[model samples]
Target: MIQRLLIIFIYFTGVSNSTAGQGQATLVVTGSVHGQLDPCG
Candidate 1:
């Protein structure tokens, strides 16, 4: 869906920009999801 396309766009952009220059780069991913808890053991 929409999420998959967003992930691909971010990946390609990061790769292309890095190869074109030599400089420090930063990537930050932030989000908040509200849903039912799932047991993880």
Candidate 2:
């Protein structure tokens, strides 16, 4: 569980950082994911 959460955190952080631009908002919609859905905690 910890490992999976870690991977997700790293992935999202990397993606948001790379894709996000100045004065821009990143709309990340995670769906169709089994096991853990919605935001963690």
Candidate 3:
């Protein structure tokens, strides 16, 4: 049982880490788009 729990924890942690990385990437892309739209600023 302990082994199973550990596996689940590790899986979830990996998934969350990946999701956070993706979120950061998305933010960076959005920032680039905004800069293009408002070049005068």
Candidate 4:
């Protein structure tokens, strides 16, 4: 749903913004999300 779309969006942006020498960028996903996430903040 929303979460999957978010990840795909981030991935494309990261790929487009990667450096010449960098093969790919890494995203650090740090949080306490379990079941449903509250993104109203």
Q: Pick the candidate with the highest lDDT.
A: 3
What are the per-residue Cα lDDT tens digits for candidate 1 across 1-41? 35754674576557657755322222222211111122330
lDDT (Cα, 0-100) at 15 in candidate 1: 60
TM-score for all predictions?
Answer: 0.41, 0.46, 0.45, 0.40
Clashing pairs in 3: none
Give lDDT for model 4.
0.49
Of 1 and 2, the candidate ahead on TM-score is: 2
Which residue pairs show backbone clashes in model 2?
none
C-alpha lDDT of residue 5 in model 1: 46
Global lDDT of each model?
0.40, 0.50, 0.57, 0.49
Ranking by lDDT: 3, 2, 4, 1
lDDT of 2 by residue, 1-41 (tens): 56776676666667667645312323331432334565653
Error of 3 at 34 (Å): 0.5
Candidate 1: the clashing residue pairs are none
Q: Model 1, stretches more than 4 Å misplaced? A: 20-41
Q: What's the distance in Å from true for residue 15, model 1? A: 0.6
lDDT score of residue 13 within candidate 1 = 58
**In model 3, how large is the Cα lDDT of residue 2?**
53
Q: List, residue by residue over 1-41, the lDDT tens digit for candidate 4.
A: 57765885576566657675234333322232322255653
